[model samples]
Target: MEQKIFDCAIIGGGLAGLTLAIQLADSGCTVILFEKESYPFHKVCGEYISMESYSFLERIGIPLSSMHIPMITEVLVSSVNGNSLTRKLDMGGFGIRRYTLDAAMAKLAVQKGVTLLEQTKVTDIKREGDLFQIKTAQGNFSSKLACGAFGKSSVLERPLGRLTAKSAGEKNYVGVKYHVKTDLPDNRIELHNFNDGYCGISKVDGDVYCLCYLTGSENLSRSGNSIKTMERNILMQNPFLQRYFTHSHFLYDEPLTISQVTFKRKSQVANGILILGDAAGSIAPLCGNGMSLAMHASFIAAPLILDFLKGRLTHQELCMIYEKQWKEHFSKRIKTGERIQHLFGKNILTNAAIGTLKLFPKLADALISMTHGKPF
Candidate 1:
C-alpha cells in the first residue's frame, strides 16, 4: 500500500486531540486522528469544566448555551467530618459528561473534513528527517507533525522514554466515577474530603449527578480491593458523603475506575512529538479546572502548530513558544493544585482549612484563583 502523509497526525481523540484537529483542519491542514476507543464512551472525569474555555468551545462548534447543561456558579467544600464552607465562584463553570462532550467534538471534527480514525491505536511513532512515521493496527502512515494527547498513561510513553524511574512509583492513586440520580443543587459544585482522597459532585446533563472521587491505591488494597468497602469505611466517614451515597441511586451497574493516577511533572515536547493535555501534565483533581486546562492547551498549541506547518516558524521555534506559553499558563496552576491537595484528605487539616476558608473568604478566593486561569 502506498503511504499517505498527512499534515498532522494526532494520537488520542480526547478533548485536546479532537479540538486541535478541528482547529488545524479548519485552517486547511490535512489532519488525521487516532483513538483506541470508540466515540460516545464514558471516562473517569469530574465532568465539570471551568468557564475560561467556554468561548473557545463555542468557536469550535460546541453550543454550550443550547446544551442546557447546568451552569455551576457556587462551590461547597466539606471536610471529612462534614464541616463545610460555601463560596461564590467568580468565574464559574459548567458540567457535561465526557461521553457527551468528546462525542460531540468527534462528530464536529468529521464534519470539518478531518480524517478521524476511531478505534485505531497508535502503536509507535518515529521521526525521520522532518516527517513522523506512525505505526498503528491499521497500517503505516506519515505526517509532518505528530502530537501525543493520550491521556495520563500509554504504552507509547515507554518507547518514547518519557517515563523516569520515579514514574514507576508515582502512579499511586485510583480514580472512580459514577453518574447517579441525586438532588444536588444545579448551580453549585461540591468537594467532600475523605481519609486518603476527595470526591467531587456536580450536576451534569440529563438531570443526573456526576459523583467522582480520587483515592490513594493503598486505601483500596487495605479494603481488599473492593470499591464498596473503601467507600463504606473511608468515604462514608464524611457525613455529606454518607448522605449522598446512602440516598442517591447510582446509574452504573459498577463504578468506572482508572488506577495509577499521578500528578508528577511531565515534558511538553518529547522526541519531536508535541504532547498536550494529560499526556503533557495532569493537575490534581482538587483544582476542578483540569478539563479547561486541557482544552486551553489545545487553544495555545493550535496557532503555533499552524505557523510551523505554514513555514512561518521552525519546529524548534514552535516547540519553544509552545513550551513557554504552556508553562506560563499552566505550570503555576498545577503547582498550586498540588499544594492544595496537601490540605485535603486528612481529618484535622481539612477541617481546619475549611474553617479558615469560611472565616477568611478572601483567602479561599485567592486559592481558587491560583488554581484557575484567565479566559483565553
Candidate 2:
C-alpha cells in the first residue's frame, strides 16, 4: 500500500501550531500536528492577549464569546522604585491561561479534521524533492509542507540553523510564571517593575490570576542562581510586587520558569519550513500581545498555504510572500517592543519616563498603539 501523505505537518501544538492546523483543516487540507507534551499543560507566559485577535479566534472556532473571559480595560504601570501610572486602555486585552487556551485550541483542531498527535516530538525535518519527511518519536510521516510553531526555544530548531543561537555571551532572560489567587480587578492589568525585571498580573479564567515576570539572566546569577533568591531580593524591592508576593496565595510550590529567553529576530522561511510565532520573531514580553501576534501569523499563512496546496502558487512563491507579509505585519511591532523594553529596567530612567508618560496620557496611548495591531 502507498504511504499516506498529508498536506502539511505541524511541529509544536501551541497557539500557532494548533490554530494553523485548524485553519488548514477547515479549508479541506490534511494536517498532522506533533507535540511533545499532552494537552492542558502550563507554559511560562503572561497569559494576556490583545483584543485584536478576539474576533479572529472566534472566526477560527475558539468560542471566545461563550467562554466569559476577563476583559481588561485599564493598565497600571509602576517604576522600579514603586512610582506608578494608571491609564485607560484604548486597545484593551483579555487574560486566558495557556493551560486552558492551548488545550481548547487543540481540541478544536482535532474537531476540525486535523490529526492531533500529543506527546509526539518531531526529531527532525528534511525537505527532499517536493515533500517534507517528518521523523517523530511515534513514527515517520510525509507532508507536502511543514511549519515550525515550536515557540521560543526548541531542540528541533538547531538542525535547521534558522535562528538557533548559543546562550553563552548572549543577553538572555528568565521568564517566571504562576497562577495565583490575588486581589486584583479583572478589568485591569498591572505591571510592576523592579531592577532588571518587570512583573505582570491580571485575571484569567475562573478566579485565577496569572502572575508572570521576565528578568535578565544576570539577575538570577547575581542571586546565587536561585529563582527564590532573585524574586525576594530583586523583584520584591518593588513595593507593588512585594505587596502581591506577601499577600497572594500562590497556587504552585515552584513557579514555572524558562531560561535563555532571547528576543532576537528569526527568519520566517527556512530550509523549506515555514516558521510561526516566537520561532519567527519574538517581541519583548513587555508588549503583552504575543498570543495575538502568534495567531495573526496563522491568519496570514492559512490562505497562502491553501494557495500552495491547490497549485495556485509555487513553493518558492509561497515562501517569499509569507516572509514579506510577516515582516510587513510584525517587524514594526517587534521593534517598538524592543525600544520600549530598553526604557524600562533602570530605576531613575523608568521613574522619569513613567512620570512624563503619566503627565501626557496621549503619548502613553500612542506608545501602546505601536506595540499592538488592529482587529483581524
Candidate No. with top lDDT: 1
After best superposition, candidate 1 residue 353: deviation in angstroms? 0.9
Which 10-residue span in candidate 1 carries the lowest summed lDDT? 162-171
The alpha-carbon lDDT assigned to residue 286 of candidate 2 equals 83
lDDT of each: 0.92, 0.91
Tens digits of per-residue lDDT, candidate 1, 353-374, equal 9988889999999898788788
- The global Cα lDDT (0 to 1) of model 2 is 0.91
Give per-residue CA lDDT, model 2, range 1-376, as digits (tens): 7889999999999888988999999989999999999998999999999999999998888888889889999999999889899988888999888999999999898888899889998888999999999998788999999999999888887778764546565678999999999898889999988998889999998679999999999999999999888889999999999999999999999999999888877889989899999899888898899888899999999999999999999999999999999999999999999999887787888899999998998999899889889999
Pairs clashing within candidate 1: none
Query: In model 2, what lDDT does residue 11 have?
Result: 92
Q: lDDT of model 1 at residue 78?
A: 96
